[model samples]
Target: MLNASNPSADTGITPARRTTMLAVLMMIYTVNFVDRTILATLGQAIKLDLLITDAQLGLLQGLAFAAFYTTLGIPLARLSERVNRVSLIAICLAVWSGMTALCGAAQNFVQLFLCRIGVGIGEAGCSPPAHSLISDMYAPRKRATALAIYSFGIPLGTMVGAVSGGWLVEHFNWRVALVVVGLPGIALALVFRLLAREPVRGAMDAAATTVATEAPPSIRETIAHLFGNRAFLHITIGATLVGFVGYGTGTFAYAYFIRMFHMGYAELGLVYGLVGGLSAGLGTLLGGWMSDWAGKRRRSWYALLPAIGLLIAAPTYIVAFTRGEWITAMWWMLLPGLFHYAYIGPTLGVMHNLALPRMRATATALFFVVVNLVGLGIGPYATGALIDYAANRRFSASGLGDFATQCPGGVAAPGAADSLQSACTGAMAQGTQDGIVIMLLVFLWAALHYLIAARHMGWLKREAVASPAPARQPG
Candidate 1:
């Protein structure tokens, strides 16, 4: 057994092994999201089948999953700080994958919601441990790029989920699609178990490579350390806000296209997979590369790049939503989809820099707590509630008879004087569109926070120059 006081550092991993490890991890992440996001494409069908409201759907997509996912992350991350991270990741993969398959058998809303919760429990185990391992494998200069490559799984998963799940749904049904996406991860878990070798904690940190792994930080110690860093706190907030709007709008985007443009599942999948996925994936990679490139000149550019990207994203998103035509809207949507993802690499890169080597996983968990609970937990649910509220208000003003009884989809706006079908259609389209539009503008708020973080980072860099720290990477 490895001694607690003299832990072994990972040594002699070949270039091939490093590349293989990264590839496998990325594949696992892709599978992770494939299960997580397939539900997004299935919304229109699920709504019709269950006769549920948007608010309830929002709960399924957001709070039900995010609550447990975020809440469980800290303890799991704390465990990872000591345990074999490879084994931990494998177990998590199986748990979430199995739960995702179980989602297919759900006959009702409650059953499906419970299954989603289970999947969340599994997914929470993924990124924190993986981030810690990757940081150990790569030096400071290359860490951001590596993490960004890992992040490609997100957009890649979105694309695959949208396409494959959508294709399955178009050909067969949503339930079948759910089972298909969920089962593969179980096998992939075994593959990762066989292949990945855990690295020494802090091996990639300058000069810290020689030190043995220290005792894991306590939760209080971890939190205190994180909160003490102003730049990390601000960047965390910016990431949270990004997730809020990003997840909120994403949860309902397919539904919007369905209601407004009458696009079918296959077409929606095509647009999201080909356009949104590729653009977002490329943008994530570009952000990491650019963060490293510009950050070489001035370290503060890490946060500065994200600020500029979010500002650009905010306006383009508004333009995308407000467009009347779907083709025109998709063209506009492409830009935001690409640029909006700029935060992932830098935000995470900064957090790793801020925390101690032993605290990387814990710090990652904390980041997720904010992003998942505050952002994912509330963003989609709040937006859904907004749609519900706006639609009801519109329906009430229209003086329509009970909307639930008359409308096919049973959504109505109070202010519209149209017939039942017209009322439902108009209300659904207008309410969802407006709710998303409002959420899109929140990017401006996130951008402001990133700017604040950049200022704090600048000051920190100056202090470090005055007295250098081992953790500080060379510019």
Candidate 2:
């Protein structure tokens, strides 16, 4: 067994090897988000081509992908505890990539939706095992920074998806864009399989007594233990609400630009991609580094940092969304993510730190189940539904006939009267603007939960330090 005090003494992980593995994992995660986010980046084109409503688009973005993704995460995470995580990650990467490629071939709404479900199913195996692997490699003190580096994949992948997806859709059709982004991951999977090696389970835990030689707790036990803790419960709730707002806004951000500003697909993608990547990436790194730095002194900093970030992000987002010009709006966009994404590193870090090494993957899977179900599952759908409601109301108030009958896909029928077209255009823009602003408000509520979690974190920390050894529980 490796010494807990000096993990590097026995583990064969040289600095070079460790860096390589983290980079490989980060790239794999990047591809994961690329596949997941391409649909959203290409959403406007997909909506126009399929003649679908915002709600249908939301179903495709949120529930279709999240349904199986959230469902299969736990079982796959459980399997990770007993199997080779590197192999599992490689397999999942290939499956999701293949499924993403198939999406290009989908001819209609139903077909595309099914293809998205496949993508979700494959992606379900990704982060939990990866998180387990990461915790094994980094000690508790460094876990947040390491995980934040890993989490950097979120913005990086989104950037690649938005930038590449936009340019491809502008040059070719949306089908070609999807295919182009999807096919590359197969080769990446092969590369990851060859390059990545699984770290010994629990190698970095502070106490050997809590390491993976002990049998992992049963699913029931794990769930009960996680939810029984007030800190974890509140963190989970706060993260869920944040996810809800993030997904809801992300799903329609491109649409908002196109409808309100008439921005071209390529320009919009490039601008949004840069803004998101730079700002969110900086925010993620800052969150991790700051939390780890501040947390060394006070554990509650982990929760407090996220709360403060969210409070700042909410109002800044509102300012950005309310801007008249796209350029002006995007300028405001850069500020919120810097504060908004600070939660991710600290949250994941805290979750892993709170659990025994054996329970890390399950904890992550469970965390995702709640976060994805309500956040990814309902957020976009709710926003889209609200958009539809608001647009219809605004259109009707203009003395126009039913909005749905007069405007299909938020555009007036071809050769329709100028006044009708104007009403449709203005209503669509206003509705999208309203929906995004409403979603931003949820960030305030999410911030409050983090504050509550902060109050409980000190107690949780004492409990953890008091019990260094694992207690036997019946299976």
Candidate 3:
């Protein structure tokens, strides 16, 4: 057993082993996101085939998946506090991967919705435990960068999903796309289980801390402790708002390109994959590296960096959405993600820093609940509803009887007149564009919250210094 008294003793894990572990964890996360995002890449095809409304698609993308994913996260996280986190992650990996493959078989909205829920339930077990493990391996000063590297999985997976899902859907079908992406994860899960070694919890904390000896806090206690901190509350709120805009816009971006630009699946997929991947990957890393670099001088930089990034992202996003041409829009798209994603790493780092070592997983679970529920659950659905409403209003103005009946899946019915088809296409393109612009405006609100959180930086600094004290035992 590693001595708790020595902060330098990190369970005899060599630097190479640590790198390999982080790499595997990141790969697992990449797989997690690829399964989650493949649906988005194939959304237009699925919409056309199922003849579902935008709202239905939103539910499939957001609420259906997020409902169980967020709800189950706390319990799974609590379980991680007791069991082997690597084993838990492996099981979840298999479950979600299998569910994702099953999604390829769904012929209707309800069936696909259920499969997405299964994917969510499995994904719920991923990040909280992973965060705890990473925190234990890396010291406080390096946690943000490490977590940000882990978060690189988000963009990496998105890139792979877009590129691969697009090609698969084009060459075969959406069903094949899902199955192809989903099956590989089972093998990856087995590899993760065999390779990852559990680290001693809190081994990197100050010598006075008792996290290795103390029992994990109850859910109620963890919630109470986290909510009691003003900075955590603000960070959660800011992150939730950002997630709202990000998920909402992201869910429909490919659909918008298809409707408005008339780009084929494979072509648009490659473009979106490269653009989103590079920008977001850079942004995630910069957020962590910049925060850590600036945070050394002033702890408030953590919150301030995200605020600054969001403020810049909002206007650029507006410009990107408003562009009439796809080429110009893609160019503008690159700028915003570089700034918009800066919040992810810093927000996670601060939340972990504020909690006791044993409370870390629970804290992550709680934070995810709020962020994913509101952001992932409602963001896409709300945006889709907005697009539907706007499209219907425009269609009605053109003397169309009802948008839904006249235009199923945002296109005119078969054998419809060219005039009606043209109207349907115009209404959909404009509606989607308008909805995305409105959602982008939410970034400003999110940035404001981050600015407010910066005001409580002293509180975060104090918590870090005071973390060496023993945690209160559950009664």
lDDT of each: 0.81, 0.88, 0.87
TM-score of 2: 0.95
Off by over 4 Å in 2: 1-9, 207-212, 458-475
For every candidate structure, what is the RMSD over all alpha carbons to the true structure, in angstroms?
4.7, 3.5, 3.6
lDDT tens per residue, model 1, 355-443: 67788888899889989897888988888888877766666666775555555454443554457668777777888888898898899
TM-score of each: 0.92, 0.95, 0.95
372: Cα error in model 2, Å: 0.6
lDDT of candidate 3 over 105-149, digit per residue (tens): 998999999999999999999999999989888877778899999
Residue lDDT tens for model 2, 1-475: 1123335533446667778889989998999989987878898899888888999989998999999999999999999988888899999999999999999999999999999999999999999999998888887778899999999999999999999999999999899998899998889889988888877777676555456477888989888777777777888999999999999889998889999999989999999999999999999999999988888777778888999999999999999999998889999999999999999999998788777778888989999999999999999999999899889999999998999889998889899999999999999999999999999999999999999887776623533221111222447
Rank candidates, lDDT, best first: 2, 3, 1
Of the candidates numbered 1 and 3, which has the greater lDDT value? 3
lDDT of 2: 0.88
- Worst 10-residue stretch by lDDT in candidate 2? 463-472
- Give the Å shift of residue 355 in candidate 1: 1.7
* Distance from true location, Cα of 183 in model 3, Å: 0.6
Q: Alpha carbon lDDT of residue 267, candidate 1?
A: 80
